[model samples]
Target: MQDFTRRATFGLGAAALAGRAFAQTAPPGGIPRAETPPFAVTPEPGASLRIIRPARFVEPDETIFRANAQRFQDKFNVPVRVDFVGWEDIRPQTAVVANTGTGPDVVIGWSDDPHIYAEKVVELSDVAEYLGKRYGGWAFLAEKYGKRHNTETWIGIPIGGNMGPCVYRASAVKEAGFERIPEDHDGFLKLCLAMKKNNKPIGFALGNAVGDGNAFAQWLLWSHGAYLVDEEGKVAINSKETVEALQYLQALYPAFAAGTLSWLDPSNNRAFSAQEIFLTSNGVSLYFTLKNDPGTRAIAEDTQHALMPKGRATVAPQTSTVMNAMVFRHTRYPKAAKAFLAFMMESEQYEPWMQGSLGYWAHPLKAYAASTVWTADPKNTVFRDAMENRFWSGYRGPISQASGAVAADYVLVQMCAAVASGQATPEAAAREAERRAKRYYRNT
Candidate 1:
């Protein structure tokens, strides 16, 4: 996989150009021609599949996804059952499936999940490679998440990412003495403090939020040039860099709205929509939620989006909720599962789903950058490059089972929360995080 910092320079213009080129030649309702043969895997007789995935954040996400599933069933004559659960419950449910060896045939799960249960999941290289060849290719982060550590084997297929950028009120930002959110950390902090001084405070999830908490904590850590582990997958969260990151959090925490210490994934969204918070980090769902409601139209109109500001890293270091599709080895219909996965990713099904998502799910395939979802709203354009700018869950290290365990345990989120809430000092929080992280990374 390419270094995301270097790949960040791959720029949206280049991606858009490539997308246009692919669109020009693509057959209507399908992918363009490829030298590789089409996916020809045959489903087994009496095939029926049960899939588990996180519930949708936006209505269109579920609507389009279920419709696509129905299309697959209508075309293949295979019965498909999909179960949507809360995002926080997904990991534990997937773990149950992995341990019991008899549950859902397919699991559409979050980052590094397939890595955690790699041994129990069937390889999908054929499915992933075929889609990559047809759709131009997977984004750099998509390829990283799709493949296993130190090998070409693909344990899962990346569906897309729920990208959480900096969503804020434009007038509030201007009232705080900034024309726009700054791209550098000091300026960003000053803007936050200014917002608080002006009585329009910012807030991000600091509790056990599966998405928002992790995104904010990971961005805070990585932006300050810290990581839970180094490239060799060794625990390294006790350094001065880690302490500095925690201390930075301490400075920014006071500018947040009250009760942020207990805020969950939906808390910030609700707070932002109610005008209780002037700024937050969230998917475009927040904006659309406000837009679709007549009562909140003004707030929706005031909303704007930007990438997270850079710190010592001087690069985009945001994290996202990456969704991956993995088939269990215990499934009675592996070919059927693979075929279904392939069918969902084809241009016919994927393009409309991507657009219908209203920019909530960032595309994993490079070709979908041309989707009008990004162009229809200028505020959404920032997310089109989310996969390019994001670092995987285990930054500076190979994503593995340990990385998955660390994320599942919420070590980074806890460390940030501990320091921000004054439960621990910066140094103490870093040391505690180090000890906790080692429990998972020790074997690595």
Candidate 2:
């Protein structure tokens, strides 16, 4: 499989720090790279703070981020260099620069990134508390994704998150003889089975889909009351709930289209847009893409989103990316970095940024929920209640380096894929996954 994570491109601007391009070259892990748009901020003489973040998959959203950073620079008179890295490479890139004390002053990364770089980043308790008090408090998931378990330290500030609601063609569901979408596990299975009769197979990423695959797999396991680990970070995958989850996946495997096992983040998007798929789990990116394109407007109009169906247990699906901004201790301008983050969080700046995303970025702050963006569309509102359901890969386990390791390695997704492909029995897959997880959680 092509390494989607390594295929990230850098966006270097003319005003980039020291005129050096942080653009693409294969990093240590065999990850590939690409270059993004030019650097957005033009640093003044003697102004030298730099921030690195994942470039949005949507080009317009990336522009919004750059514009917002420029706002910070114009207001604070601090020339901030912003480097937008690819989603697959951001974590590793952050790790490399952070450990060596030479990365950006600020970084925006996915869930558990704060946990992964907890020691190397500055404690953000003061910043978090200030934001919490001023913004009517952080949402539960924000707190969960931003801080270490059982500690007062805030490793990063949860800004916003990307949601993975079940995106489907509403027309397809009705054609399959369902009055509404499935609400329970068995009902959902029956719907998929029905959809299969017409060859409109349900699609979920089975391969190295860093976001969709992991989020959907965890949702399946959690719905069955299974957990990858216990609350304290112990390996707890070998169980009835887990076995049932795998078996459930195996039963549904026949309903998935061919090549699903190799799908990455962009695969389902293309499939849905082309009308080749009836159902899949993904963010609003697919919807937004379709909506913005005149040629695909029909598909966009027909698309709808909902929460993952319930199983033996009722819980919200785990979010794929709980986005946060981290400041490194090695930053020569810690104060400037913090100010930039805080300035960006203000309602004036944050709302417009979310608006530019067109429902792709949901608010991590409760107060921001009242933004018109959430109510502008049915697809957006359906995900409002889902915002609080977000959980990192560590879920029942503590968010630590071990939990981060498991997520980065795509452990649960691989386990489910193994069963679905008949490569291993559910029991064997569960046991092997447990063994692998034990190795990751060894020190924690």
Q: List, in order, the clash count of every candidate structure.
A: 0, 9
Tell me the tens digit of each residue's lDDT in model 2 across 1-444: 111232434443433222111111111121111232322333344556777777666654555566666666666678767776766677788778777888678888877877877878888777777677776777877888777888877888887777787888888888899966676778889888888887888899988777788887888898888998888777898899999989889888888888888887778887877777889988877888888888888888888888777676656555647677898888877667767777777665666667767757777777777766777887778666444774557778888888888888889989988998899999999999888888888853
What TM-scores do the predictions have? Answer: 0.92, 0.88
Alpha-carbon lDDT, every model: 0.82, 0.74
Model 1, 392-444: lDDT tens per residue?
79888999999999899999999999998889999998889988888888864
lDDT of 2 at 327: 86
Q: Give the TM-score of candidate 1.
A: 0.92
Clashes of 2: 9
Cα error, candidate 1, residue 284 (Å)? 1.3
* lDDT winner: 1
Candidate 1: global Cα-lDDT? 0.82
